[model samples]
Target: MAIAALQHLTDPRLAGRIVLKIGSSLLVDGAGCARADWLRSIAGEIADLRAGGQEVVIVSSGAIALGAAKLGLDKGGRATLADAQAAASVGQIALASLWSRSLGTHGLTAAQLLLTLEDLEDRRRYLNAASTLARLLENGAVPVINENDSVATQEIRFGDNDRLAARVAQAARADAVLLLSDVDGLFDRNPAEAGARLVPVVQGIDQSIRAMADGGSASGLGSGGMVSKLQAAEIAERAGIALAIVNGTHRAPIARAAGEGQGTLFLPRRRDGARKAWLGGRLRVKGVVRVDGGCAAALAEGGSVLAAGITAVEGAFERGDLVEIRDPADGALARGLAEYRAEECRALIGRRSAEQAAVLGYAPRAAVVHRDHMVML
Candidate 1:
């Protein structure tokens, strides 16, 4: 229970890591492009956090908006998928330039990373992307992540950057996620509608809260709505990452949210490091390995999956890849970092670690899969 309580952030995770998402609505100036003063203020706040030893990554959504403004496209109407993608292609450069200039004022560098769902889906790419983001944070540079809007097709899209930010938080092993928007936080209903009120704290996700969310219709310059925000929160919560939704109208809202509790915070059910959280929360798996009920219990109780437990292995993959671990009777049990190559794992089924030398004629590593690299589903 205390671990669950820890999710709400009694003390700021300032010195810890965080992923901050800025919506298109929050980044646009009256002229309908990136706001320099607002960005400068945000960069200053981030600078302050970094000075205090905090690591931060920003997931910003404003490329399409800026692109539309620059190209003189219809500001109030929907764009075809092609139209939107083209705008994003042109806008991302300008957006990054603006952010770079602002961050330069604080003597900090911002690295632009454009990603799509494809990047997070493959094992090697997932590891590589996570490594890149981690190195940037460790080097004290702010990583600016955005949807690879220009090249992504329908099948590989992250519909909103909010959910992507949540995944980024998990990938970065961040302690918190801050979502900046035009409004302050989630309201009982649309705040623009009468009788709506802001709900300050959310303990868990429920249908009552889900019912209050609006649709994805953008108000001219922004794309996400309350629904995307809630979805993003759910993703973060499931990964044991705390989320805060705050108004971006004020300068340094992120710092204020962390220090003054000015935003609506959604707490997580548990605390997990990045690798475990990602392994546990991944929605898709490349392959499945079924084990007996005994093996499932061992894993649930914090034991490593042994070779004897593996009954079946499906899919073609190499060692150091991600594979799903399941109970033969009940199906999905957990996911782990595979130690043996897929073909080798199949050949070694029902064999012990000590038997590796006899079976393969070469002494192998001790574990079929190690607990340190695994997460129970």
Candidate 2:
């Protein structure tokens, strides 16, 4: 609603927080040098949004590209993982300096954060990252985030900034995500083909929509294509966040995306709780807690999973790790952050605090998993 989300919606919604995913090509060239003027324009746009009371987070790609140039990597050949990481190691500093200078020119402060997909996957690290972003926003500093290419391996890498931006949006509790690309947006067919037309609005990422992106690959110097944009849209949709893919190569691309039918706007079905959204998006659960019928009924009524209600603790999980809550029938009910370590939880089974204290020489935490940190599976 404000300036980055879908302004075309029948009712304009106030999407206060937004995350912008800028591809490598938009930031640099195949030679990996910074695109100074274009970056400044973007910085100015960000400043305008901030003046209008909007908080922005950026997931920028270009470190590797710039680094490649610094390292003298071939423009025509693919860089190896080590080469890419090495390039990122050198370029990250330049990338940060570029953003800092650009944003500073507009009287805005820039904060940089390097992250890996694993960072977002781990509950503790995710919370830490989220907290850092929140504090930066609170202080009116625009955060420029990127994948930790210098340290991450192929097994743990996000592969592209698009999905990374979506995950960051969820962590930052953003209402919208904007992916700036070379193309205007998703087209009905390959834009190179005759009669190809842009799809202004995507209601949802269905089979037909995905099929439209079949041949899409990375554009410019970016490593991702239209398929990556769709994947990002899917992630945003899960968290009730709207996503837009717009042509950043043009003037006022952000403003253009806000205009009707100017970009592909992927709408969310509805807004979901930030914690629930994060919980549901997690692909791994460290443990399972089984509760009795009464506990299951209470949980269904929106109650927490209390220590006295838990019948069994399965799996080895540390405190603050992800866990699954199950019923007497062993059916999955919900997922949450564990308040106690698996060992501690096992010791607290069916015991009151006083009883736990008598047996273990200390009182234990009240719940196996707090309702506030849980989401129904």
Candidate 3:
């Protein structure tokens, strides 16, 4: 069956490439370590997807819990980064080994891939990561990815698997990302509090959505709470990838999210493709630049962002960071990701592309943002 068939059977918006993010809380029991039966169940669901000819990549988070169990750490205590790393070192091996064994029983193969922030941030590395996952799908082997916690320092840790899952979805060009956790879905307020209500769907990530977040709760095995889950959802939505935050404690949540049954489902924004959405949905921007009225009109007509139309620059950003491109005449014409850097374009501002070399002392690229990269809003 086609991948879209799964979505049509489940939810029309849910087919295509899928990434399942399994958090630590769902992977272990109170005593910690990989839960054998749970792993089996997960593997079985994965096998079903593979049999259906759908691609599935799992972003798993349980190395710390696995290591802690092996080393005997309690739930409430704090572990130094060293302690966490040491535990992850031991746990990651055991975790991958267990998954391999479990999947093997179902006549499936699992490939272990360890990643750090560096692997996703560098363009070459990002492409390499995408290529590796794509190859695994083609071979009918499930690619199981995990953050390399043992060696990751504070600076580059994915912090939680939620963000990691979103990044992976973008890299793999996934149709959806399923984040399996203890909660059934997002709530209007703390679910534990008496007044809270279950929010069936969220159309956009806005201030209203932000108000609903209450940090980590009962499932202490993982670091992310509803807030982080929403953050991950925002990432997926921007990439035109559907996302669902569902309770992982159930027998087959991943399968359910794929459309066989239950979970809190989210639809992607209908307006743009994955690449443009990524460029527009940045949480932090390095800089801002204003454009003249004529430039704004041209951009609205699907023209490239050019140096001659730039009126002002703000902030400092390097190549590829999401930026604000505003119309000097009015802010209404502003869109995101016009491409050229603040420093790089500052000198060429007000000068035609041909005169750019003589004025800036170097031959600069023609368009501030090539038409292909800039998505007009």
Candidate 4:
């Protein structure tokens, strides 16, 4: 069944947001210098996507490789953490400049975002990062994201851009994730072996699927191998995001991946439901809000939880904390990330959203929990 799916693998009609992860090997040569021609070709592809009204976010790896080349550390030895950090600092500047220049030729602006694991793990920081990416896309700029390797220790680092790309897809609510790597797609066995074949469409990831992945980087310049990409697929799957792995060595690889379906596609398990399940299951419930019968009905109809609908707020939860919503009878209706702190919610219960300013000192949002942030039980 999987082999049959491979024969007909074609790109789905991907619209709106897309996250493209570029491996270090695709961006740097053996000498560790940025591949100028390849970068230009990719920039052209991104420009085409944007021209067609698609928002593109790039999670790129190459700063360390580029830095290593520049600092004479590319002499074929494993670099120390300090050496890696120093190289990242120098390479990041060159990387940003290269991307900026490449995209600039096509009249596109590139914005650099250096992130660490903590940025996505912390709820408040996650929202901030999401908002920033949204704003960049809204303003017609492409975000070039990279791990903050300069200050990141081994314990705090994401260790691979494959997983980082998946997290970015969740944060941006991207429609699709494209991993540009050395290989065309996932195979049942090593491609170098005789009779090895591509497995193009994966509906679900299982132990057998995972067993297919060999644990070594595709190129010396990259740290993530097939295993990391599969792990990334699982993360993306939980967020209900489609993921594709494509060979990025070809010219206009992004265009080919999107149009010709030149890669393996991992279909999402359950669109919105998967994301809601992941969100609700992962967070700790810090508080509860009780609402009237009318509000309960509204929640059931998939409406946002408003201040006027809330009758009472319990427990001490801060903004961005996960909280539960309950009916007047104390039956749990839903759980969502709180927009306002517990004290603020207490002061605004039963008050109309318009009257929030009069009831409290300020009113930033009308809904206590936005529909997008809420998971209905």
Candidate of highest TM-score: 3
What does candidate 2's lDDT look like per residue over 60-163, in tens digits? 99998888888787651235888888888998999999999998988889999999988899778999999999999999899999999999888888888888
Name the lDDT value of residue 212 in candidate 4.
89
Task: In model 3, state the lDDT of residue 233.
Answer: 81
Error of 1 at 234 (Å): 1.7
Q: Write the per-residue lDDT of candidate 3 for residues 95-134, one digit (tens) a residue.
A: 8988899889988888999998778765578779889988
Candidate 4 per-residue C-alpha lDDT over 156-214 given as tens digits, one digit per residue, 9 for 90 to 100: 88888998898888888887788999998899988788998888789878888988897
Please list the residue runs of candidate 4 whose C-alpha ends up more than 4 Å from where it truly belongs after superposition: 1-13, 74-78, 272-377
TM-score to true structure, per model? 0.72, 0.74, 0.78, 0.71
- Residue pairs whose backbone atoms clash in candidate 4: none
Model 3 residue pairs with clashes:
none
Candidate 4, residue 296: Cα displacement in angstroms equals 29
Model 2 compared with the native: what TM-score?
Answer: 0.74
Off by over 4 Å in 2: 1-5, 8-13, 75-78, 215-220, 283-377
